[model samples]
Target: MTDAPFQFFDVEVLRTERLTPAVARVVLGGASVSRMASAGRDQRVKLFLPHPGQREPVLPDTERADWYDAYRELDPAVRGVMRTYTVRELRGEAGELVIDFALHGDEAPAGAAGATAHDTGADVHGDAGTASGPATRWARAAGPGDRISVLAPVQEENGGYDFRPPEGTDWVLLTGDESALPAVAGILESLPPGLPTRVWIEVHDPADRQDLPTKADAEIVWLVHGTSPTTTEAIRAAELPAGTPYAWTAGEAATVKALRRHLVGERGFDRRAVKFSGYWRRGASEDSPMSAADAEEEA
Candidate 1:
């Protein structure tokens, strides 16, 4: 591992599965995966994918102190395609890491047959839309034995996640779209039993709803994009548990912002008590330039 807070790990896809209509799960395995440690809830990692026609990603030299600067200097078209994703589960015993991708952009046909590990370069069917991003394309086409690289934490106490509930908190609130499902699931799994927890998840399709298993006394409500009320609307209408509440919300930038404002401004929640993140904006790709305000929210 490098001497930095994050280390680069080369991995191969051990397997992949379509979890839901909008979510795909990739199980990655490599000798290096055994040494990687995650802080669990909402742990973020930088995934580097090879460009089309390349077998593996071209990454910056790990020995360098300023690896990110070196990466930025490389040719964009040839260098690795980097995107941030959550570590859904880290199974050290199995030497594997799991990541779930929310299918977006131009997607493969609903009935299309996915290629197997042996068929590495099969043509995928779908309409090519301007909104399609490399990450979305890569996830849809990824197969077993496919190569990728990740920048992950080597320590358990790494501050790469943001699901801390302060002491004296009586209840918890979690909300997000499919983009934030992995994080919400992780948080739910980590909560103590009998803790009063409320969740509001929004997804484009009802089939995207996941069976989130948690030990906590959690009340989860799924909101289909066109069929159900918005997260803010659901939260506003429901009666919340008494006492100090810790809230975590993520998804589209505008939706996250609206939820945060409602919690802090209208509901009288302490600004610091609510941990929110904008996983993506409605029409913008991750490569889009972020404004100062967006950077602040992400930070």
Candidate 2:
């Protein structure tokens, strides 16, 4: 965690747009998120989507580690779908918070299927399992005026933010599948202008390719599934700059693990300089203890 403690707020949907066939862009608006100090890049926020036909989402009045316990006490039908995601863009002047949701993917398109547990990319569960989850299904049909609850980072320590770049590091390396797009995009925006970098993103659909804006000297590499190297392989193939290059990689659990191993164990990249995480695991749903969000919550 890179920021302060998190606080809960009630927010309404200001608008929704289709970024791609499988991705939905949602803007959550209100004084809570709009007036919030920027949580910074790659910060995490918990979204409590409303139950179908319900006007508001059910949320716990507690905080710290107790909130999870209290939230778990609610009826599943009323609790709705509780998932985590990265803050894509912060619009303080407009009093809005932009979040991209990768719509549900398992039985349909994968990337941008549901608001991913980490980023706005992919969902780990299939439609059969996600059919009842409010986040995915609600995102599929969510419209303006619909409301949800957001647990955003507070100004105190351990507030659920995740960005951490070491001081004096010269260059950067970033890799992830579609599931990490939102975080990666936000990170790119935060980097120092014109810093040399390498970015590798893996996605199944060409439409998932986005025109990510960055002031860094970023070389964008789109690794299309079935054609380009595996996300890990692509990372292994990329050339990092000289003198203490920091790397951050994420996405599917197994692949992220493999990339970490390749960077540290095999390639001799400094262990402390490489930041990686498993965004989601293959063949696992958000309910599984192995899912990324579950692990983070428990941590």
Candidate 3:
């Protein structure tokens, strides 16, 4: 049987707000956005950004037999850059959805020209420079009437680090950088009430931490860089309580990998009980091709 065809939808920015100095929340809306209500939390979708002057992006006809070629033949300028981001929330009432942007420091690359343009002027650095690419620039500038392109959610077989607590596990361990915030938050919000869970998050500062409503008993430890000598390192140094605990970790590729080794290899935690992912790698550009060296090192 043929695989289900991928669906593409066009959307527009309805509003935006700064959640923190480094995080910006963008709400997208349009008739097509209502369909996203079925998307699962933590599911990632590709965002396509139009060129600086274009009002809207033209998506390839995935239905065509030569869709791949057609996609390749599209004008590079209008092709719109792509980025993998999670669906934070989907509201059917206004056909609105939200995604958060981790503003890279001024040294980072500038984003494309759309929803993100207005905020791009700030001198943020890090992956944001190149990571933002075109979609981020467009996202920053995106306003109530701005039009954008969105593809149907692509559910990966093992796309994200799962956080569902294992049966019999009494404790939970959660760790990641700012990029992992959305997924971490989604996991925390979905837990069953009265379950005991402990979360450790590493961020640039204490302010990056946000209160999450959950029925499960949770203890959150926020690790801040600069103030804390070892932000990510502290997570590794932390001693897990005596008991089988479900662990979830994601963040910079190298750091997450280190924690994975410590928990599973050194600490002897069951590999199946832990979920870990590398959201991004330090000093790497989104446009740069992935390399074997990077993979081997992270592994």
For candidate 2, what is the lDDT? 0.70
lDDT of 1: 0.77
Q: Which stretches of candidate 3 lie over 4 Å from their true place?
A: 1-6, 37-41, 65-69, 72-75, 107-132, 154-161, 164-166, 229-232, 283-286, 291-299
Candidate 2 lDDT over 1-299, as tens digits, reads 22335667778899999897656789889876654555567777777777777888876664455768777788877775677677787777888888887655443464433334322232432111222244557777888889888777656245455667789888888887766888899889888898988888887778888988999999999988777788777766766677777888877766777888888987788988887776665444554455555533321
Show where candidate 2 strays beyond 4 Å.
1-4, 62-65, 106-133, 156-158, 291-299
**Candidate 1, 103-126: lDDT as tens digits:** 654453342222110022111111
Best by lDDT: 1
In lDDT terms, how accurate is model 3? 0.61
lDDT of candidate 3 at residue 230, scale 0 to 100 = 50
Candidate 3's residue-wise lDDT over 9-29, tens digit each?
778877898786567788888
lDDT of 3 at 164: 58
Best by TM-score: 1
Question: How do the predictions measure up, each by TM-score?
Answer: 0.90, 0.85, 0.79
